[model samples]
Target: MPDHDEAVAAALDSYQYRLLPDHIHSHRADPTLAERLIDSFLQQLARYADRRDLDIHDTLAELHQQRIDRGGPDHAPEYSFRLGAQVQPRQQPAGDKAGNPLWRGFITALAATPDGQAQCTVRIPGVNQALHLTTAELEPADSLLPLPTRTAGIVIHAQEAEQTIIDIAARLKRAAGNGLATNEHALADLAQLTMRLSAWSGGQPDAIMRHLYDRIINAAHPPPQD
Candidate 1:
């Protein structure tokens, strides 16, 4: 589980990787489309205010004018796509944004990895150029990946959430005896649990369960006889 802040952070991260536009310049060039995109972004941003902590005050018009003057990090005015209710707008430990060069790319593929991470391939603007970046590296501003509303349906029903905790405990018992680690289902369920826990506990259980899960996974899978 993540705290309100951490969940908020992760949501922002997801939006960057799964929402933002790939070819921002094209939208920037089209006045009508660009305006619409900004409006959508603002509306979505406002909708999530009850669930998030954003510090935005300006409207679509102000943001547009700011973009025209300041542009993005590269100094070109470009607009990103509409973020979903579960998506966020900012990232933490934002060191990469400070100096790294961001490339415009579209996520070509997504796959769940054995190590509990998502593997994604991205197609850059130029022909025949693709980059392998995971969900951790992808962001709405840096890549164009579409996330469906199907995910928004993952509401935290009280009974279901309680059952999830019970299920996770049972799996831990199995892991201990089986010397288990890297179960795909366990990882995915844990991730979803974190998201739901954020809603239930406002992030109180996030760190506790996360640390416990890591310890169990490590204990279950010790090094083989070498």
Candidate 2:
């Protein structure tokens, strides 16, 4: 009989062989595309589990519900950005090509026009009112500096650290189960951290770092009771 790890690997390989096309298999050469494919697969699996009443944790279900509550549009066969996701205009607005400063903002809402065009309501930092724009007009605001620069290198490192934390937590939960009180607290904390990280507006890195440090310190040494 195959061991648990070998069985899992064999199942995954079978699924990939059956489900993935040659074009999709080529995505393994690109880390970003591969990560996105894995996330999509997991989300689909979560939905399948929910349909079969097998979602015990309900963590992914809750995340899906939150996405819907945040005005994420449901247009089948078309991808839509969820609310509160940081994005930048793909092109500069008319008469605003001076310094070409990086304009970043969060998706406040989503809508569809009568013409069937998807739109996003974005709240830029310095802007007073939210601006409504087409989905194609915006892209994810993940890069603060040009590639190969020191700041970009740090961003890559941070991304790797975030992914490592998530991967470790996922493995620990799967190995030991989420029934323990300590595991529950850890999951809750990790969820909150995910929210905070997603909502970051790419400003005041020092302040963000300090806030995270304070959180770790407080968690380690909580306040004394009276």
Candidate 3:
């Protein structure tokens, strides 16, 4: 019988290749299995963190920092996606001078490979793209290629929608500038486009997943060996 850790890792791997939201959602609905998978994955991540003398919260924070750094050597290639929960602006008190309040949330990012470690890069120049993880650095979760949510029901759908938006924006950026565009503007455009697309479809989750699995993944990865 497969051990629980193996089972959890397998489920996480499945997320990487899952091509459709319906397929993911079909599995996720009322997820007794997902719960087990999630618990096990968290435990594994925790263990990895402990081995590093780190914590899960800290690890997630490091991922956030990596996004900010856009990883790599000085002037080396770097990139990341901007997505995640957003805080709704609270209504200002009637007596207050300003009507607007600030919104806040976490956004994801990926640092590109540093120059000397070109071997770490998985490139598709035709797609005008590449991705990298630090040399010898172990990741508890996948490198945010596809953001998997642990939540269920509407929350899960929402997280998936957020991920799709990020993926689509990335595609549009490559299409527009072949990945040479500035990261700030590119991320902004992606945010706007994802929000619009999500609203337009009333959150038809599968469209985003389909576009990514069918179109984007090829551009992100190298061709397989003959």
Candidate 4:
């Protein structure tokens, strides 16, 4: 039931978490592989936009804006992996190409080599020496932790709240159409809701939702006069 944008976002997230490392690892020797992959991905995105009747240029612009809003290319994973992030070797190091078991480790440091090539220093447990590796040579360690009960509950509640809000708006529309409510009042209410939703600046959602909840409760229960 997701809209085109939501679906596309989900697909991109999946590709990043699931397939990107493999693609990089497989073409580690080819320095131009990242550019080629990006070009191919953009072509695929254009095709998807065409099929969805979306303007490809606008979609690209929106994506670029989002990246800028998210701290720009400096924060991109390709530029620097977060320190302390768990990672495993994706490619064997030079002179250690006996196809031995790759050790999982935590990124202890990040820096560029003399030639300006970015690299990570990973600390493997029980191993005295740390491994210096490029981004293409490492992948995030597979998650082994179980989902927290509280986190799961919050997700379920949020989904239910989203559906309830949609249903309430739909019923309001139906009531307005049937003359059970004034068109002017209904339009004003809907417009206010839209404005509030649009005013959200990608901060904590609970804050805005709580404000709306207070407004609804106050409207339903007026204060007593002296």
Candidate that would win on TM-score: 2
What are the lDDT scores of the predictions, listed in order? Answer: 0.45, 0.51, 0.41, 0.49
**What shift in Å separates residue 92 of candidate 3 from its native position after superposition?**
17
Cα TM-score of candidate 2: 0.30
Q: List, residue by residue over 38-133, the lDDT tens digit for candidate 3.
A: 666677778888899875785576566554443323423443222332212223335324543222222233344555432233221112123333
Segments in model 3 whose C-alpha atoms lie over 4 Å from true places: 1-30, 58-86, 90-226
Task: Give the alpha carbon lDDT tens digit for every residue of 5-91 in model 4.
Answer: 466555555655455655534333444654555576788879988899888796475445434423423446433456665566554
* Candidate 3 residue-wise lDDT at 114: 52
Q: Which residue pairs clash within candidate 1?
A: 1-206, 3-203, 16-139, 16-140, 17-139, 17-140
> Which digits, one per residue and each the tens of the lDDT, describe model 1 over residues 31-81?
775565656665787778736775555444444543442332334424222
Q: After superposition, how far is residue 128 of candidate 1 from its true place, in Å?
A: 54
Better of 1 and 2 by TM-score: 2
Distance from true position, residue 159, model 4, in Å?
33
Q: By TM-score, rank the candidates, best first.
A: 2, 4, 1, 3
**lDDT tens digits by residue: candidate 2, 129-170:** 268888766665652221122111322222333333344355
Local error of candidate 3 at residue 63 (angstroms): 14
Q: After superposition, how far is residue 87 of candidate 4 from its true place, in Å?
A: 0.7
Best by lDDT: 2
Name the Cα RMSD for model 1. Answer: 17.6
Each candidate's TM vs. the true structure? 0.23, 0.30, 0.22, 0.28
Between 3 and 4, whose TM-score is larger?
4
